[model samples]
Target chain A: MNIHAIKAIYRFEMARTGRTLFQSIVSPVISTSLYFVVFGAAIGSRIAEVDGVSYGAFIVPGLIMLSLLTQSVSNASFGIYFPRFTGTIYEVLSAPVSYLEIVIAYVGAAATKAIIVGLIILATAALFVPLEIQHPGWMLLFLLLTAVTFSLLGFIIGIWADNFEKLQFVPMLIITPLAFLGGSFYSISMLPPFWQKVTLFNPVVYLISGFRWSFYGQADVGVGVSLAMTLLFLGLCLAVIWWIFRTGYRLKS
Target chain B: MAPILSISDLSKTYDTGFQALKTVSLEIEKGEIFALLGPNGAGKTTLISIVCGIVNASSGTVTVDGNDIVRDYRAARSLIGLVPQELTTDAFESVWATVSFSRGLFGKPKAPEIVEKVLRDLSLWDKKDSKLVTLSGGMKRRVLIAKALAHEPRVLFLDEPTAGVDVELRRDMWRVIRELRDTGVTIILTTHYIEEAEEMADRVGVINKGEIVLVEEKAELMRKLGRKQLALHLAVPLAAVPDGLSAHNLELSDDGEELIYTYDTTGERTGITTLLQDLNATGIRFRDLQTRQSSLEEIFVNLVRTPS
Candidate 1:
């Protein structure tokens, strides 16, 4: 199982986060808090509630999902990509660790970091809005599933990217915009019927809707559909990761 | 005892169609220093990369202590350590942390004592806490060695271990390598410095253009191909060598003041006594004479310079 190798890689990555606490944890936490102040408090006070939930509270799950998606992708991508860029990947490649263990170590650490940041954002959100969890168990499941799934996507991106610009390309140009338009600051139902249909194409919507359903128990799509959709996306990411390891993709030549 | 490492018919052709290695084969004893000497682009690095599992080989197989490198990679790799050519490291990591991390990566249990010993042996103990980015190039090279040794592998492959380092660090590195050898760890190194091979190698292998030209014990290689030259300074200038010395194939100096005779050192008869007698009979008076033996560098150059 090479458990020691996994632990070594995981601890090394976690230590890197500790060393760069400001960029890794504090920066994202502060940014999400600002989003709460500007959008939830300042702006929500002027708008009516959606789905019987207050506007500020309505965006909690969406905001948390937003942070989870971006942070997971960035963290996981950079975790693997930095070694490749610095030429230190030779150590990892030559080690007795298998491909599965490498994926587990890198993706697990990234998910852990994303989950920590999500929790911190949730705590900060409490100060801005009255929050409640109708199904705490479901909420935790959604959090873990979302964190792990996006982290896997990030792992694929890390292997696929050849340059720093390409590394940032997917997370910044693709993920952030999808999360914003998917449902972060508002419900997809608020959009016109046609645009609401189009918004379904954005995979982030399924994650946000599934996560929000666990909180207030009212979601735009049926909760069952949201769960299925999340799992489907998770399955897709897993398949891609398996293919990467099988083919050695950009990780080996 | 069985060889610690064996390579048979290994070949590598990169994606770009560059054939880096071609049917290479070699073996290493359990506790000897084997030096692979070659010039740039001679497949030294490619061969080491394949054995270390960093680069996949195009054909053939390698085994470490009877564990097939591909089929049983974990067991095979666990027995080997590689100090790569480049000084690549995590810039933000401390020396102690990185070395410990390497040990753990090899699936070894945490042994701080072993890590400390490796660091101290490489003269990196005092700087263990310093970030890698802050260390000098020589210190970073030492840290690389410390990382390779952290796991206590049975065999160590050093790819250009002394390249670009200062003389003092090079000497320290040699001392550390010798100490490792004394501990019964098999050592294989590839080097551009023939003197490094001459100074440390028990057996030397010369590679050129993706082929192994020769592999022999250092002493035997030097003797087999080595040529000795005898130069005689004549008391008077002469236009050419004496007719009596033509059988000896002697060369006259451009200024005609000295004569040079070349002979194989490994030959049963150097004919020095007979040459001296013939010189005296021919009245070829000489003021002084000196003999020189060719160095390993000359032999290596001759080995690689010719077509395979």
Candidate 2:
């Protein structure tokens, strides 16, 4: 838990996240521009505004969160998975550095990359479509909290995965589709009441809702509910990662 | 002085129900090159792995410099560095960075000069900037050694350190090992190469089928357990051996050109002269004679061939 150890581990891990910087900086910018073209100009003409703001402006926060979640998970998973693949986990397990130091270092680096990507998407969204933040401070807080929560979730995925395919399988197939269905591109209120209730069960809805609330002063869910859900998710992820480290799961064996 | 490492009745049963180690016990002095010899399925690597704390012991205890390995893991691990059988290193990392990072992993403050010296000692300074994937197999092996030595461990374990390398690299590795030993480091090596143990070890322990069959001083072990062979060049090619020469217990070469006699050197009386005279009385004569000693490999084979 010493700062020196954390610095070394963190430095090494961040240096290894090549795809994070590439995907984080490029994916969001590209995806946000495309979303502006397809959903803003093409689709916006067909549908009316949802919450007093333009439809293009409505999807900005959700698009940013999309990139944030995927980049966060991919960065953290690859960071831990490479060591296991290369047999360097033996070196880590045998080292004097504690498990908490390792968790903090990796999760922190992933969060840093995720946050940077989030900011870039937010800035890029302005170039294509005009966007404004109603609660700037809460927006920053929500962005940071979501990044940390997803980064920790990625750490758990990294530890549990044995192969490269398995690493991508969960994030790409499960998490992304769930987030998309949770109303990243459209509002869930447009669906039947049964589906609306079901959307509430999706953890990503709270993250997207919280991020959307940051901009335009409008939110589908209560601001308190979204913040509380994010904090709860972050706590759950930290608990899982801590338990894995404590039991030395997949690490010692 | 107390022994540097002690293990009491250590055993390990893997999850698959394969017993890798069976109630093994030994004490290694602080500055000796102890070689553990065994065939492919033996418990040599298992024992070393347990001591290095990579694998847990099913039962029994291990202590390094008076610290229990399980109870004082960090202290004990910091005292030992293991060069694994596999040639694993950071494929993209420069040799200098890899070795220095290994030192940092042990919680040691950065010491670039010492790291440089260790690299230079291993003849890797020239390749310090080269990526590990660019290095040859032998060079990669040396990198593994440099990384293990970066922390300056008190006890170093080389587990089959030279498995597939060529003769030149193997010799160079031995040279470095000797230099390390001279500096008062305890070395415990596991190898299937009997010649390696014969050339370098101060003492040898043979493990077979999850058991330590024998442990003894190299010279004394050879002297006490080894057999000598006497071969006689025949004066004339014999169609068959005479019945009277049977008491000498001689074996005829397949070509019928030589007679082979085997005896124990440790015996007070070899009876070679008596056998020669008896052969002469039986109308046999030899143009020349030769004697040979059994090698460590032969003795190793004999030891493993014995029943439990």
Candidate 3:
């Protein structure tokens, strides 16, 4: 709660990101541009529009969500893992900082990076896809909410992870692929009816659809339902994070 | 004055079924240097961890200045600081930033002057701007100490503060520790080096096998447990111990070059005079004789070797 503690946490975490700042910010923008070049030019030229929005524009929200989710998770996970790896966690844990203060600081710093990367990807997509914002405020809302939600989830992952390998295992093998298959590049409607229903089971579909709803004012799922799913995921991630901090799971024992 | 930290019937058992601490009770008085001595895996770190609220105890309680460590952790933790055995600091951060940030963890208002003084005390002020990874191993240790002292806690625990430092840094660290003690801070240090505790501790506690074997004043523990060895260099090497000199516990060197007699110093008679008379009666003459008293290291080994 104290500014000094928050600043210290932010500074320490931001210092970690600062090491790869150029990568965190630039890589997403570049990747997004590449996607626009390949997917927008190659795929959009053949397919006019998926849901009354141009194919290039339709994929924008999902791409931004992909970048935001992965970057947020990676940033927060590494932010916390490095301390344990370098053995600096002992100093932090032994200090007078409470569990809540530590969690908020690291998660908040990670959310900051994820938000920046999301914005940059958005801007890059604008250059190629004629991106328009049906509801700019809602777009920001989903962006901030998803960033914070994933950041908290990443915090828990970092604590549970024992080493570097484990840190990447969950995000890379599980979360990223799930997000990609959950309709980041294509609309779930393009799939067969069976696959379309199956896509509904992928939690990431709700995040992307919710974000897309804010952008093009059209979604495979209801916007309110998408928002509900994001809030649900946020609550679930927060609960897990709170439990880790309270139990002193990997951080203490 | 009252003790700043009180641990009563504290115990910890890890999930691996290792009982690190058992029914350990001790009081660390304010403004005193208390040393915890033990062999590897004797739970010195566990005890410190429990007091600092880093590791929880399975049972019992630790109170720092009347605040229970678990129930009132915020207050208890705020009053104490711990320097871990590992020299773990933010490698990419400057020494000043790391130390100042540690101060902030306790929600302390910014006091750059206090931070500078602490760094200066630990000889880390010059390297304040240097990144931690750029410093040598000894400098990293000093930064850890500086961070621990940044908040100016009433109690400080150094868990093997000088495990692998060079001689110069070790001495300098002790000097700084002594200075901190002089300033009325309670310091509890755990070290593998017995000489550190021997030289600096006012009271020493020996822990072994999850139990506190003994806790006594340094001088008192030495007086009660220390022994002396009278090593006699014979003019002629003896082939075997004579029957007449067999009454005393005398050990002949493997090469038959010397005879050694171990005696308890606390006893009324050391039996030196009688042993010399017996040696002479047995027609044994020693060209030289020397006596050496047991050091804290020997006493510590003996103390832990005994059943707790």
Query: For this target, which candidate reaches the highest TM-score against the unseen true structure?
Result: 1
Model 3 C-alpha lDDT per residue in residues B49-109, reported as the tens digit of each score? 8888778789988889998887877788888888989877766788888888899887788
Among all windows of 10 consecutive residues in model 2 chain A, the one with the lowest summed lDDT is A15-24
DockQ (0 to 1) for model 2: 0.44
Tens-place lDDT per residue, model 2, A25-82, is 6766787788788988898768788878788889888888888889889888888888
The residue pairs that clash in candidate 2, if any, are none
Candidate 2 lDDT score at position B227:
90
Q: Write the per-residue lDDT of candidate 1 for residues A79-155, one digit (tens) a residue.
A: 99999888889889888989889989999999999999999999989988999999989899889999999999999
Candidate with better TM-score, 2 vs 3: 3
- Tell me the deviation in Å of residue B16 in model 1: 0.8
Task: Give the per-residue lDDT digits (tens) of candidate 1, residues B1-308.
Answer: 88889999999998999998999999889999999999999999999888888888999899999999989999999998899899999999999999999999999999999999999888899999999999999999899989998999999999999999988889889999999999999999999888899999999999898989999999999889999999999999899887888999999999999899999877899989999999999998999999998899999999888989
Question: Highest lDDT among the candidates is held by which one?
Answer: 1
- Cα displacement (Å) at residue B262, model 2: 2.0
Q: What is the TM-score of each predicted model, taking all chains together? A: 0.98, 0.91, 0.92
Predict model 1's lDDT versus the native.
0.91
lDDT of 3 by residue, A45-143 (tens): 898778788888888898899998998898888888888888778766766667778878999999999998888888777788787888989899999
The lDDT of each candidate is 0.91, 0.86, 0.87
Indicate whether candidate 2 or candidate 3 has the larger lDDT: 3
DockQ of 3: 0.59
TM-score between candidate 3 and the true structure:
0.92
lDDT of 3: 0.87
DockQ sort, best first: 1, 3, 2
| Pairs of colliding residues, candidate 1 | none
| Candidate 1 Cα outliers beyond 4 Å, as residue runs | none
